[model samples]
Target: MKFMMTFHWVPDTEQRAEAIERFLRTGGVPPQGVQLLGRWTSADLGSGFDLLETDDAAKLTEFAYQWSDLMELEIMPVLEDAELAAVFGRVAKK
Candidate 1:
């Protein structure tokens, strides 16, 4: 199954950037086939996210935990469309 990864912090851009950079610096790579859609630090800094794509739930969760270990990510939620008639298409799954 595919998962949507999101993180909410207490609101700090400089720290957020630093953390993300630090993560990459430490060679933190997500699961295979995961695609980074985009990332944003809220104007209020209440939260932010690096939009990503990953079909491997296990690997994705593993990587996500690493981030939480390094940085205190507030919230992480996964979602999916239950409708069989989704307009776009089905999320390719194994």
Candidate 2:
């Protein structure tokens, strides 16, 4: 399954700096079970989005926990456009 992980950093300079430093040191890689598709950050560096694919939701949770202290995280399951269209097609056929 694919998931969208959105994050908003805490409104604190020190925390943001620390998170950034850590990211630089660690390369901001996702956990073992999660495959990162793409990552985007807001122009102001306030919030960001990540597209990831994983069969194990627990890996996402673990990844969130790692950064939960410095930022708020929202993990949401997502489907590709074609996948959603297929669902709609089935409904229309019914």
Candidate 3:
């Protein structure tokens, strides 16, 4: 039960940053089994990329909700190598 968490801001930079910072400090999200992966933010500088590993859907859902309430956010699954290969199948012959 892996979950990917994304953040999309629906407010001004200052407000957004404040929310994010607060989340980081008190979100209750587990620090173990999570990776930062990669991130990109050209505006507001209030964005991050996180790779989360959890087997409990309930916990993951709570984590997502916490982020959503903090800032306008979006999250989606990022499959692992095996999962990605299974979904995409073999590469086309060239």
Q: Estimate each model's TM-score.
A: 0.52, 0.94, 0.58
**Model 3 poorest ten-residue lDDT run:** 28-37
Instruction: Note the residue pairs that clash in candidate 3.
Output: 8-72
The TM-score of candidate 2 is: 0.94
What are the per-residue Cα lDDT tens digits for candidate 1 across 1-94?
3344566664566767877687669755565666666566677655566666666667666777867744555434445555444634666453
Candidate structures ordered by lDDT, highest first:
2, 3, 1
Using lDDT as the measure, name the better of candidate 1 and candidate 2.
2
Best by TM-score: 2
- Best model number under lDDT: 2
Q: What is model 2's C-alpha RMSD?
A: 1.2
- lDDT for 5 (candidate 2): 94
lDDT score, candidate 3, position 49:
49
Give lDDT tens digits, candidate 2, residues 47-70. 999999999988888888888999
lDDT of model 3, residue 28? 40
Error of 2 at 13 (Å): 0.9
What is the lDDT for 53 in model 1?
A: 66
Q: What is the descending TM-score order?
A: 2, 3, 1
